[model samples]
Structure formats: C-alpha cells, structure tokens
Target: MSSYLIRNAQILGGAPQDILVDGGVIQQIGPGPTVEADIDIDATGLILLPGLVDLHTHLREPGKEDAETVLTGTQAAAKGGFTAVHAMANTTPVADNATVVEQVWQLGRDSGYCDVHPVGAVTVGLEGKELAELAAMHGSAAGVRVFSDDGKCVDDAVLMRAALEFAKSVDGVVAQHAQEPRLTEGAQMNEGTVSAELGLGGWPAVAEEAIIARDVLLAGHLGARLHVCHLSTVGSVRIVRWAKSQGWDVTAEVTPHHLLLTDEMVRSGDPVFKVNPPLRTETDVLALREALADGTIDAVATDHAPHPDADKDCAWAVAAMGMVGLETALSVVQQTMVDTGLMNWEGVADRMSHRPARIGRLTGQGRPIAVGEPANLVLFDPAHRSVVDAATFATRSRNTPFRGLELPGRVHATFLRGMPTVLAGELVDQGDLS
Candidate 1:
C-alpha cells in the first residue's frame, strides 16, 4: 500500500493536527508535514476519528450466507466507519467449537474488509443446558474472549452462574441477551399501552430488567465480568447503574435504534420497527440517551442482525427481530448524541470505538491517531446529510428501520490498515484473498 496524508481534518478526541500514514501505520501527526504521499485527502471541514469498533454485530456467515456474508457485512461496517466488528455466534452450525469459530475468523481475514472477531456461543446450541467449550473456544485460533447466547437468553440461573464462574478462570466475559423467555414468549412488541391497544402480547420491561439484575449479582458473586446486550428499558439502566455503584465488573451496551427510535413506530405495522428486546416507550428512549450520556452505558453497539426479505417483510408477529445496523450506526449516533448536544465527537469515539474495543479485548484496534498506531481511521463529514436508502446498502439484507429517514454526518472514507475499504462514502473493491 502507498502512503497517504489526511490534511486539515479536525482530529476528534485528539489535539488538532495533521496525520500522515505510511506502511500501514500512522507515521506523523503534527502541524506541518515535510513528507509527501501517493495521495493527499483534503479534509478541511471533516472530523477524523479512530475507526469504529462494534462489539455486537451478527454477520451471518458459514450458514445464513444468503442474508449476510463476512464480505458484505464488513463492507457495510466500513461504510459506517468501522474498522472491526465482533461477529456473533448464532449461526446455523453455531460457533461454539474451535473449527467453526476459526472458519469464520479465516473468512473475515480472507474477505479483507474489516477485522472479524468471532464471539463463541455461551452454551451448546444456545440451549442453556450444556456449556459450550468455553476454554477451548477461547484458546482456539479465533482467540475468542467474548462468549454470548445472544439470540437466546441464558435464563436458567444455575447455568448462568456456572458459566460466569467458568469464565472467571479464563478471563472471558459472558454477554447475556437478558430476556426472560417465559415473560416474553409470543411477545410482539414492548409491553405498554401501544401493545395493549394493538391486542398484541407485550414484552414487559421487567423481563429484561429481571435477567440483568440476576446476572450482575451472579457476576459479583463469581468475580467474573458481565456484559449486557441491547439494553432497551429504563429499568434495565437503573439496574446497571446500581451494579456499577456496587463496583461489580459489569458493562452494558445500547443499540443505536434503542437510542433513537421507539415502539410507537410499530404503529406503522412495518416489520422494520420490530426488533428483539423490542423498542420501548419514548420515556425509555430518553432514559437510554441519558444513561449513555452519564456513563451508565458503556458503549453503543450495532446489533446489525440481517435477515432475508421473506423473513423481514412479513407480519409483525412473525417478522424477524432485528435490523441491518452496520451501515447506519454512526449516522444515528451523530444525530442522537453529537447533534443533540448530549455528547461530543470524543465521546462518540469512546462509546463507538475505544470502549467497545476494550470490551472485546481487541488489541490492535481503537488506538488514538498517532505515530506508530495502526492506520485504522475514518474521515467523517459531520455536516453532510442524507436519507438512508436500504436498497443502496452493501449488506445482503435491506431491513434497516432508518430507510427513508434523513440522517447526518456521512462517512467520507474509512481506512483499515492503510487500505481504503470505503472511499468517498462508497465501498471499494476488496481483491480476493486466497
């Protein structure tokens, strides 16, 4: 790869400076550059941030390839300014074993789009009965440190406790889906007036809060780390805060959708608004935003779950419970956090890139833009605005809730190890990696 200089961009979360990249590392970042490069990007009005890292992304590969492959999902991730995304382990074969996890890791390496860290399944087939080979998966070629039963909840308290205890020895964290299955069975939307009026079974907030309350205490008891996924309720935020007050080793993430949209969108009867731990009330949305602002939430993750059109374009009760998030995560954050005065670009970097990287224990990622740091970077035009067009996305699925919605701050370019994965807001071709 040739050298490049990103000149005049406001380096978010860093002192004002210019950055020069050579040999896939940031070589110099200062006021004046005596060096020349093959390319020099004029970034006069843009903000430069570390390439985003997502701890929760569902790149459905090795099985649900029709919905998303590592290539397409990471391409979308690049478009959203991500340099790495931890791929969830909820595929058809279930990435519970070393072979499957390593295969997925190799595919991401071969795809050459973004760094893909495979998350191991917390339980065998996510059954919550038998523990998957936690130590083996952690020691696999994938070097998986994050384990989760994301699509299914680890509802059995005894099993959850055991998993937490086992993870403590390996220094791995267990991310829980945090839904009480018995309480949310057949539930179509958030448990509130809307669901009641729609005559749909409500998924009560207590269901999620109940599980989180249990897991944090379990983590405290076992001296293990815990991560809560896609926290969507106000009550859940209070529990996480209380856990932190007790100094429990717990971290939680909120989805971009939960931060911006609400269950009232479900009145459209559009499946796009349907998601797991379903969108809650406007009050819950405000609480999530405040939690994110006040540090009660650790990060903002794109639960970028993809599904085929047939699965998502159906009735609300039967529709899939996710949206394609990789392409819109940063834009939504820019709208909800930056533009709203709730956070600055530095806070955005911490939540979207730095903190998430730490959570997944990604060593080579989320570094500050400086000499000798890896050239994982993004040039963001905060003033830019556009409507989200799902048909134009790089992912195989078009299930985003933000379709036709106007969002701000487009990603101008994203560099992964000094190679342009996205240039001028468009995905560049990644040559075949044999």
Candidate 2:
C-alpha cells in the first residue's frame, strides 16, 4: 500500500504534529514515530489545511482547448492547493448533458492532478428555454450534483422555479449567475462614478441583486438548494444574508477578485481587469469580507475563467470577461481575508475546502485533517510572499489581473490521496502510479 509521513506540520494552524497517511486514508495523527515510508515530507513550520476545493472553475475544454483543458486547469488547481474543482458547464457544445460531463470527468481522472467534478447545465444549451436532463447528468458516472448555466442566467421565472422543483427530487443545487440581462444591457464595467468618468457602459448592482432576491425566494419556496456564484455587490450580500436569516436553503460565494479589487481598477483600461459581475466599490469589498468572515457568505470560489491571450488582448469594449484565478486564489485570500484579520487559517480552510466540498456533494474532498479521513491535504507557507506572474501560471491562459502584484502565502505542497501532485511548489506526475 502507498504511504506518506507528513512530519511536524501544524494542523489547521494549531500545534505541530506528525500525520501519517496509509493507502489514501489518514492512518494516524499526533506525535507519530518517524519511520520508513514511501514518501516523507519535512513540513515543519508549514500550516496544513484540508485540500482546497473550488465550486466554480471554468476548464474550457472539449472545444476551447486553446484556452484551457482538464489537464492544465487541474494543474492550476493543484498549484493553488485545491484537491478538487467543479468544472463549470459553459464549454463549447456546453456540458449540458451526461455525455459531455462524463467526458470532462474522465479527463480529470486521467489528469491525476485534482478531482474534477463537472457542473451540468441547468438548461438545454443554457438558452433559458428547455431544461436539460438534470437527472441523467446526476446519475451518470460523472455524478454531477451541481447544475448551472453560469455564463448565462435562468431569467425566466417559470424556468427558474421549474429547475428548483426538479433539483429537489435528486438533491441537486442550481447555481445562478444572477445577472438581469435587461438591467445589464450593454454593460461594460460596474455602474458607478468610475464608469461615468470613463464613459463606458455600466453593469448595475441592482441587476445582480434583483436576481438574487427572486431566486432565493424561489429556492426557499421550492425547498431546494440555491447557490449564488461570484456575488460582487453589497446589495447581493444583503439578499443572501436575509435568505440565510430566514433559514432558506441558500448559499453565496464571493470570488477572490471581487474581495480584493474595485471597479476603479478598470480606470486603467486594462482588459485584464475586466470580468463578469464587474468588480464593485471599496465599500462592497469591505462588506464582502465581513460577510465571508461572519458566515453570511458560504465560500470563496475561484471563478477561474481562463481565456487565451488573443481573446483578452483586444479593446475593452470587445475583450472577454474573465481572469484566470486558480493559481492565485489562496494567495489573494491570505492577503485579503487572513492578513487583514477578518479570518484565521482555520476559517480559510472552512470557506475554501469544507463548505465548497459540502455544497458540491464531494464525499472524498474537503474532508477534515483527521484520522480516518481521506488524506487530501495542502501544506501552506504563510510567511512566504511572492510577486504575481501570469507567465508562470500552470493555466494555458494568462489573463490574470494580479500580474506584477505582490501577494502573501504560498502552497509549499499539495497531496491528493496520499500522493503529491505538487511538491515544493512544482508539479510532478508521479502521483499517477499511486
């Protein structure tokens, strides 16, 4: 059986202890004896977390391999300390059915970097018209538990309600992109002083907030799970908080970009900063931080949308709306949430790993750092700070807005099932043999 000894790692940022993994399970925890092992890591001074899990990652495969593939995207996830990532359903020919999702799932299994759970589409072709065969996708080998049209919203109230009801039967979550198409017509950046000064069309906060309000009510009424993706504005947070206060089955996620960046960054006219649910104001950023720390926001998903250089290098008006995020997610969170004192390492683990896994219904992922649990884990160096370099990313695309920015924290190593996918901050394919 494969075995590993993680020596002197601080579990959940607590006291240092040795952890032993045998045959993909945590066989022992505590001051374990140092002995022969198939793999051993000198993890002294490194903070160990349950392997991070991202509920929203766009792998862009099966058609957009020019941007990203299951292999490269999972490589980015592994670099970010994520053991699992939910591949969004917006691929070319869209992952709206079991066949497409299974293909993505099988690709991830073959990659051997991170476990990729494919998010099936909520509608047939994401057209907001006919509903996709949600049950078929869920029951397929992919075992898709989350359904979303993500790049588009299910604006038809009838369709939204029907999706909620249908999801109830199979216990699936319907995650929404939450943009009101009418409200965001021709929108370019966040609707505010910056957009006015820059003479660019604006995406209003109300556009996102209105949908969250409607969908949370729909989800509550139907008694099904609703997940709000990449929540950006203050108004959206308020709606999510109210839904939670009422004990409705609704959860919200804020991306790393929204938590740290403001719409003002668009003033530079750099297409790299452009993203859907356009980055909001400083006030919104602070509120998002508070909401996440207080549990009003459930998780931090890296809306890891990777676009090739040609797509993102165009003029602002025509540039694609996304930024590659997986490799930088943990660093941004460490800088914005932990270093700012809004949350501790344990809180980061909960938001980044535990809650996301639970939301996606991933049994093997997001397990606790304890005995008898799956040995998916990350060893992070909080003291490590490095400059952001898109050129060095594992992703095929380099549309990151964080380029040239210095960020704190680093993933020293990431282990998936007692095998290292990344060791000493570099990728290795040896884990496939395990």
TM-score of each: 0.98, 0.98
lDDT (Cα atoms) of all candidates against the true structure? 0.91, 0.92
Which residue pairs show collisions in model 2? none
- In the range 187-293, model 1's lDDT, one tens digit per residue, is 99998999999988999999999999999999988889999999998899999999999999999999999999988998999998889989999999999999999
Off by over 4 Å in 2: 430-432
* Poorest stretch of ten by lDDT in candidate 1: 425-434
lDDT for 183 (candidate 1): 93
**Clashing residue pairs in candidate 1, if any?**
none
